[model samples]
Target chain A: MRVTPAVELDDVSFGYRPGQRVLEGVTLRLGEGEFVAVAGPNGGGKTTLVRLILGLERPGDGRALLFGEPAHRFSQRRTLGYLAQRFELGGDAPATVREVVSAGRLAAGGLIGPMRRRDRELVAEAIERVGLSERADAPLRTLSGGQQQRAFIAKALAGEPSLLVLDEPTTGVDAETQESLAALLDRLHSELGVTIVYVSHEFGAVERFVQRLVLVRRTIVFDGSPQELPGIWHDPSHVHA
Target chain B: MLESEFMRLALGAGIVIGVLAPAVGFFLVQRRQSLIGDGIGHVAFAGVAAGILLDVSPVLTALVAAVLGGVVIEVLRSRGGTAGDQALALVFYTGIALGVVLISTAGALNVDLFQYLFGSILTVTRTDLVVIAALGAVGLATVGLLYRALAAVVVDEEGARVAGVPIGGLNIAVAALAAVTVALSMRVVGILLVAALMVLPVSAAGRMAWSMRSTFVLAMAIGLGSSLVGLTISYYADLPPGGTIVLAAAVVFGTAVVVSAARGR
Candidate 1:
């Protein structure tokens, strides 16, 4: 039997309102331990795709599956870690790095219970992985942009998710921070064998690490290896190119 | 300070509400929904007036009305029918208008309205104390248990939902907790001033706290201190307890702001 894909979008379509679709009949799949980068221009439904895969929003048509289970019905949410774009945490939040990371265990221990010893260990481990152990107790707002991103990454890593979904993880960071994030993603994929699906508008930074590319323009316009990117970019018929 | 039995009961009730207000208010301030307390207060006033008109217990009626009002605000927010502040304003004005009309029709404006509007802590009975204790316990316990989920939602709602946190249910639960907090605090601070009691201490604590947990604990302490000190001053000065308590909290908030600015935090 074939192994179940980490994520599968079978002819999915979505729109925020009626008759104005953002994503239309897009089918994609990410196998276990695969590193895929979704590249698209602004308003190309990259974030919507992430939302569907995470079950934050449902598909208007077709299906979204995570580990062979339907997106909405998938109960093992602890297995998926999501790093949203910058400004996602809002301004002036008072949560510390450790406290924010520990929230990842909410799915494991639930909302109404105390954190166990194991949860604490996982939180510490996650923070250490992000190299923020020294600043674990510091408030998230005090951190720089890249450090805040790492803190959120630690939060996602705390859950020990097998499938990591990141949406524009390097949007507003400097070039050096972007390179660090790429290196971290590489390590996460190679060492931890975590399946990463990240969305980005900037292709040069993450192009080397991603094995496959799913270029979207309100639909799955191109789905192939990174070598085929030039062909799509050169094609005059692709309006969004 | 606690010489009279009435004073003892008032203190007991005040202490519980003092802790409960800031506990719930931490999230309210963080979420930028501090004015929700004012909206709920107005709804509770309508409830009190309805209860008087129907010859039922006003406190109990206010509890139900406030909860319902909170749920309405949540529903409107979820439906995207109105903006968050708009929803609050809608409920707030409707409630106050309904209350005034009910009271006018009933012609019960002599003493009952005065007590509900300004509060009468010295008039708190044993039954009121018991109700306050029970409701305050449940409200505070809910906040304690759901602290992580609630905080997660406040920090990043979509992230929390992706992590399998039930955002809608938890939001409603929070609104309900706020409703109960408003209802119970009405006795100590009155309908007009309960929101101040809930928000001012948390605002002060937010300026100094390094983390969320510290913020919560600090807010509770500030609230408790303000309540006790305010009650004492009101007793000696013969002023309204509700106004005095709120003024004390405001003073603390101002002091906190100054100190934070001095420390450049």
Candidate 2:
């Protein structure tokens, strides 16, 4: 029997306002454990597309599915990990890194209870994986941008999600951090066999490891292996080329 | 006065409200809605007035009215900015106006209304003590059991929502807790000043907080200290406990500001 795709969008269309379209007639399917890079120019609906997959929005037309279930109605939330672009933890927020990361396990732990020992171990391992074990007790706002991103990655990793989605996870992060993030994603995808949907305008550090590269410009303009990307369209950020 | 029954009852009420206010108000201050307690308190005043007019228990009536008001404000806030602001203003004015009209209609206008508006702790009865304990218990338990979820929600609301945290339900639950806190505090601080106890202590403790848990604990301590101290001072000076408690909290907030600044935090 054929296994259900991790994510499938059938003729999806979405817009923030009525009678206007951000994306149109988009159809895509991502298999389990596939490492896909979604890139497009500025103003493109890259964020909107993934939001639909995450069930944060409904399609203006057609359907978006997660593991063959309707995206919005899917109840297995622990199976999906999402790292939002520019997630704001207040400047003076007193939440420690460990506290922030442990929230990722909320789906598994359920509401109103203590975090079990195994869950605590997973949270520790997630922090260790992101190379932030020492800073776990520090307030999240006290960390540098790159370190903060790593903590957020640890948060997503703690969930042990089958489908991991990150939206511009390295926008303001330095080159060193991007490289580390790419390595982390590589390990998460290859060794653990986790499906990754990475959305960004610049390919920056993730280009070589992605199994499939898809360009979004209102619709799917390109869908193929990274090796198949034409030299003229080498730069993912400049879609006009 | 220390040997008097009324003094003991009032102190008991003070202790209950002191612990309840800041414990439940931490999220309100963090969410930038420190004034919400004030608004809920105003609505509860109207609830008190309604109880007087209807000859029912003021605490129970205030609870129902304040909860309904809290739910309304939350729903308005979910509609996003500007709308919520306008709704708060409308609710604020209507609360006091309805309260004035109801109290006048009850013919106890100045004498009884003064007690609810500014508080007269000497009037607190055994029934009031029982009610305060029960309601305070509910508010404290909700905050205790739901601490992590509530903290997660305050940190990043959308992030928490995607993580499957019940955002809307928890928001209403906290509002209800605020309403309950307001009602429980009516005897100690009165309707006008109960929100002050809720907000000021959290603000004071916010400066010294190293983590969310630290913030919560410190806020509770600051609130308890301010309440007990204010109550003792008022008993000696023959002053209103509501005004004295608020003044004590303000003094605590000012001290916290100066101290944190001096330490370069």
Candidate 3:
């Protein structure tokens, strides 16, 4: 008898409106600790898949499962930390970096009456883990775009999620900051044993850090390692590097 | 002096609206749906005009119309897609225009419609005050019961939906509550300034407050402070209390903006 994977989608299909099918017969599975990088073209349903996995969108047909149960049935939403591509932390929102980071704890039902000492420490640890210790007290609007993104990530990290799902985390971040974020993500998977499912267009940039590559072009074209993806996705005759 | 019965009723209504307006307005501001409240106010005015024409209580008509308008807006937003904004704008303008035509052509009542438009404290009957109190209590309780869900929805609708927050239901609930507040506030601040009452206090509070709970509490305090001061000023200066209240709120907003800028925000 084999154990079911952490996440599984069985012949899932979806459309934004009445009859336009954006994704069809899309089946996918991720084990408990797998760091799967979802790669695809610009209009491919990579982000849509992430949304379905996060239980943000209901599949038009078929079943979606998390931990062997229906994805919608899983009430422990705190177990997954998600960073959307366009998360808005409003300019006039009066929250420090630490306060914003603490917001992640909200999913865990961690806001019990008030901010506890342990919650504060968790916030501190999450901030430090993101290398944002010095800027914890700084207001969110004052930080650079990269720092702001990191703060949002730290907020997600504060919940101690078993799975981290990020959509283009390094989209607007500088190269140096992108490398640091990649390293941090790698450390999270390797050392902390966290499952990571990230969607990105830049496959070459994240190829080294990912364990499994799910090449998505509206549907699952290939599900294999980064090395195995080149032959399936690339032209064999024109292979370089 | 508060010796006069009408003055007492007006003062009481002012204070209650002070609290109710800002509390509901905070949610509107957060969701960027402040304009929705304005549309509700206009629809409520049509209800008021109908009440005057039919020789029934305007409050009842306003309440019914406001709620219906809110639900209509929600439906339009969800179903109409590209035409949502235009539909809402049409609802607002049509309501106001219909209200004007109805009130002016209403040869039966001989009641001055402009009194309701700008809010006349002298006209606030005890029955009106009682209605205000009851509706205010319901509005506040609804907000309290659903604070967590409301906070989640306002912060991130997509995230909250994924977390099983019931986005559509919550949105409808918010619209319903906004309608109620607008209708209740119409009798005190007038339909034209209902959005001002809702937005100004909360906007001022947002400048200094970090948490939702604190922001709400501060907005209430600011509202109460302004209403009391405004009422007193109006009584002494022989001016319109609603205008005074709005002016006071504007001053608070201006001060907050200045201080925030000075602090290099």
> Highest DockQ among the candidates is held by which one?
1
lDDT of each: 0.85, 0.86, 0.79
Residue pairs clashing in model 3 are none
Per-residue lDDT of candidate 1, residues B145-224 (tens digit): 88878877777666667778788898899789989998998889999998898899988988989987888899999999
Candidate 2 residue-wise lDDT, B1-265, digit = tens: 7799998999888888899999988989888888889999889989999999999988789889999988887888777788778988898889878988998899868777777778877788998888888878877888989887788777667666776778899999989999988877887888888888998998888888888789889999999999899999999998888899889999999999999999997
Tell me the lDDT of model 2 at B209: 87
What ranking of all candidate models by lDDT puts the best one first? 2, 1, 3
A43-132: candidate 1 lDDT, tens digit per residue? 889988888998878999999999999998888886888888653554244789888888777776578757888889989998888889
Question: What tens-digit string does per-residue lDDT give for candidate 3 at A165-241?
Answer: 88888787676667667777888788778888888765555667889989887789889988876555742322131
Candidate with the larger DockQ of 1 and 2:
1
Candidate 3, residues B87-176, lDDT tens digits: the string is 888889999888878876776335466666777765788998998888889888888776655665555555544444456887788889
Measured against the true chain A, the candidates' chain A TM-scores are 0.91, 0.93, 0.91
Stretches of candidate 3 exceeding 4 Å from the true structure:
A11-21, A58-63, A69-80, A98-138, A157-162, A190-192, A203-206, A229-241, B78-80, B97-111, B208-215
Task: Provide candidate 3's TM-score on chain A.
Answer: 0.91
Residue B146 of model 1, lDDT score:
89
> Model 1: number of clashes?
0
